[model samples]
Target chain A: MRADYLILGNSAAGVSAAEAIRATDSCGSIVIASPEPHRVYGRPLISYLLEGKTSLERIGYKNADFYERLNIEPFLGPGYDAMRLDANAHRATFSNGTEIEYGRCLIATGSIPFTPPIEGLDEAQNVTPFLTLDNALKAQELADRARAAAHAEGRESRAIVIGAGLIGLKAAEAISHSVDRVMVLELAPRILPAVLDAEGARLLQGMLARHGIECRPGVSAQKILVDGGTAHGALLTDGTEEPCDFIVAAVGVRPNTAFAVEAGATQGRGLVCGPDLQTSLPDVYAAGDVVQVRDALDGTERPLALWPNAVRQGMIAGRHMADDPLAPVFDGSFAVNAVDFFEASLLTAGLINPPDNAEGVTCDVRIDEAAGTYAKFVVRDGKLAGYILLNRPDNAGIYTWLIEHETQLDTIDPALFDSAPLNCDFDKTMRWERLHAGYPADRNEKGFLVKRECPSAS
Target chain B: MKRIYAIEAWCLGCKRCEIACKTQHSATRDTVKALTQEQPSPTSRVQVEGDRFLSLAVNCRHCAQPKCVKGCISGAMQKDPASGLVTSDPAKCVGCRTCVSMCPFGCVQVVSVEGRDIALKCDLCTEDGCIPGEPACVAACPNGALVYWESEE
Candidate 1:
């Protein structure tokens, strides 16, 4: 088989690129294949699905008629998982023993869960990685069993989750809804070490405590204790024995880069791609969590593994694939995320923690213990480097914009940091250019907006 | 295509546009009931920032590359390819507020209604009391502060 544009992985990156391609080359004969047995759903909202905040259907990232209306053919389910890539041949081999030659290809096969070794972990029952839709289904079944056990045995069932990062805690929160108890174990000194600072994590920990979700930092599961083929409990490294009905292996994730790397895409922390999002291999591009982007803050290249970055990269790669001339350069990325646990919301961006003994870096924090609000900003070399806004939602992105633009501190108002930023905070000229005078939403010839999906509009 | 442009110099900051916006989007579409009776009182999509002394009414720019649309995790936010209008579907939004943090102009917001949290943003008065092509804010603006027009804007 052959396709003009062959896309692997149908999540954020691949789907975005397909939309972009459809917008540019209306009759490109696009082909998308993924291992998942469903349409493109929001991977970030899988926890929300477990929590009953969203449903299976509503979690879909696009309309039900998305693939149909767009005129792209999709090959879904485990049979379609790409097994090998021959970049030189411009061909890909799938698990179902089929090979497809393509004019151009995009490998967006995202991340894979990385589970740390634990004694007797494989013997444990009801252990699952919370990554894909299928895993969520398994967790939902686990939640149901625990709920049944709560009703029958009269002893509460607990969950032992390993890790205190974003994914682990979210899984804990979702499991907490049905399960009687959830205990999160993290090896770091504070929860959410990747996104929040010490104080911000402390504030978030307090919030989690109120929800009856116990978080144990500086600890990890040393062994998975099994009783008659089922997970009975876990033994912590700190010599604490805890009982549990299930275990969640939520350690972390590594990029799924085996195919790309073996096919000679130039490997680093992730697949190395340039501003056009194309790997060194000719006509082969990569995006989403599987690729690394240059850090806008520290100038280090690392996998951002964020949704917005994937979507943006996908658009750029699609434009490059379709030859959309006005595609914007991939300007690199910083750590920007917004997540909610129960009623608490956390917003973080850029370099939350400066390196040790870093010169010309200043950290400023304002705390209101009573309100459970903590706002910290890190500045380096007289430019906005990063910020953490805990329980402060108003105009948080303006700080993100400042970090992205590397705005000089002297030009900004001192009072702006004291409160919610407004458009008036900027001088008239800047305000007019950035705020009042909005970008024309439909000027097709401008920028990467030249996707040809709406042929009638053009 | 027509779009709303803020004329800051002609601004009175009277907040009439804000009130008009809230009423237009409210369930009752009546100023008194919309403010006092609604379970979750509608917020003004068009905000008059600063004060009467010096302020600018800010709303969604509906940018060509809308960060909210791109950053939305649940696919709740969408930009219509035909109309060029960026709108939020309250049903699909998980109230993650990712879009709220992605809007550089500070336009998108989260509001609670009927015991559910969803994103709230300006839909150019499409759902409520839209006056032909003009949005409620522009039609209700006392001055020419907010203009909804076309031809090189």
Candidate 2:
């Protein structure tokens, strides 16, 4: 198959790229290939399904006619086993025994959940990695069975989730309502060690505990205790055995960059991309969870595996591929995490906790444990390096905007942190500009803000 | 695409725009009835924000790149392609307040009716066969503080 644009993977990034391409170049033939049969759906909503907060029908990110509306051909089912890219010919050959010639191509295969090499884990039937929709469905079925068994035995259904990261916590939260008990195991000293500081983690752990979810920090699962080819529990490093009928392994995710690496794309944690999201190979681009871009907080290049970043990168990749004059230059990417755990909403942006030894790194923390509110601001050289807002997360966009724009902290009104940052918090000139300026009108000629077309206008 | 623009200097802070917006969005079109109805008070999407010197009637800017829509997980919040209007579908909204947190302008709010919560924002008064060009808030502005018109690029 020959097309003007060939996109691999059909999740957030791939769908976004295809939609972006269709926006500028309506005549171009865009083909999206994915192993999943269904059209694009929000991956994060899978947990909501387990929690019964949302139904499968409402989980779809786009409407049923999304692909039809965009007029993009979809090649679904059968994962792309192999990819051979001919840089000179601008052609890609997939393992499905098909060759496609394209003007531009994008790789947005996203990531796969990492399951640790725990003894008996691979052989256990009840252990599943909670990442994809299939995994969620399978886990849900297992949970149902476990619940039924527990009911019949007049006992509580216990579930073990390894890793206290975002996914694990979400999984635990989702199944907590359905199961009798949920235990979260983490190797780190605190929960959400990557995103939350020690204080922030402690607050979240307390909230989790209040909701009856057990959190074991600084403990690792030594082995999955299996009986008759089924996982019944796990042996912890601390020599404790927890009974669990179902287990969810959500340690972390590694970029699915085997195709790009095989195609000679240089990778460091993820496929390395230029400012335009182009890979080392000609006519090849990478975005979403599979690409490493410059971090806005620090200068280091790394993979920012977040939904907003993926969508932004994908849109940029599409614009670049289509040769749109308005193609946005990726100024830099940073990590932003927003989640709700037991009615406590948390928003973390940029570097939550910079190393104590790092020069000029200062932190301002406010903790109201009784009210379940914690706000921490990490700053360096009069600029906001990062912030973590718990419970009172109103108007977090202002802080995120400041961090993204690298606005000097001194320039902003001090009253911002006191209350949720509002239009009144900004200087008069900035307030006027933000209020009057049309979307994207305030963006500069280049860098991050550029090429961010209004979803409607595009 | 036409959008509501705030003329900060002209705003009298009479809060008439807020009242008009609430009535238009309420179940009843009557201003007195909407405000006085028992349980689930009417909400005004437009706000007169400022002290004495300068007050701007602020509503949804209907951003070109709406962070609210992007942050919305339930796909409840959407920017209409043809109209360039950002609106929220209350039925689909899970009231996660993700949009409320992400909206830079602080336009999206979580409004509770009885015990159920839904995201309430300016929908440009498009419901119930309201005229396309006429928004209740913009029309009720006595001064030329708020205007709904197409901006020249």
Q: Score each candidate by Cα lDDT.
A: 0.86, 0.82
Cα lDDT tens digits, model 2, A145-200, are: 99999999999999999999999999999888888899999999999998899988
Per-model DockQ: 0.51, 0.38
Give per-residue CA lDDT, model 1, range A1-458, as digits (tens).
Answer: 99999999999999999999888999989999998989999999999999888898799999999999989899998999888999889999999988999999998999999968888777866898889988888887898898798669888878888999998999999988888889999999999999988889988998998888999999999999887888878899899899988888889999988988888789899988888899989999998998888898889988988898889889989999999988777878887899998877788999998876799999989998988788999999998898888878787878888888888878767777886777888766677778644444443211223444556754
**TM per prediction:** 0.94, 0.91
Model 1 has a clash total of 4
Top DockQ model: 1
Chain B structural similarity as TM-score, candidate 2: 0.93
Could you report the Cα RMSD, in angstroms, for every candidate shown?
5.2, 5.7
TM-score of chain A of each: 0.94, 0.93
CAPRI verdict (incorrect, acceptable, medium, high) for model 1 = medium
Give the clashing residue pairs of candidate 1, or none: A23-A451, A23-A452, A23-A453, A24-A452
Best by lDDT: 1
TM-score for candidate 2: 0.91
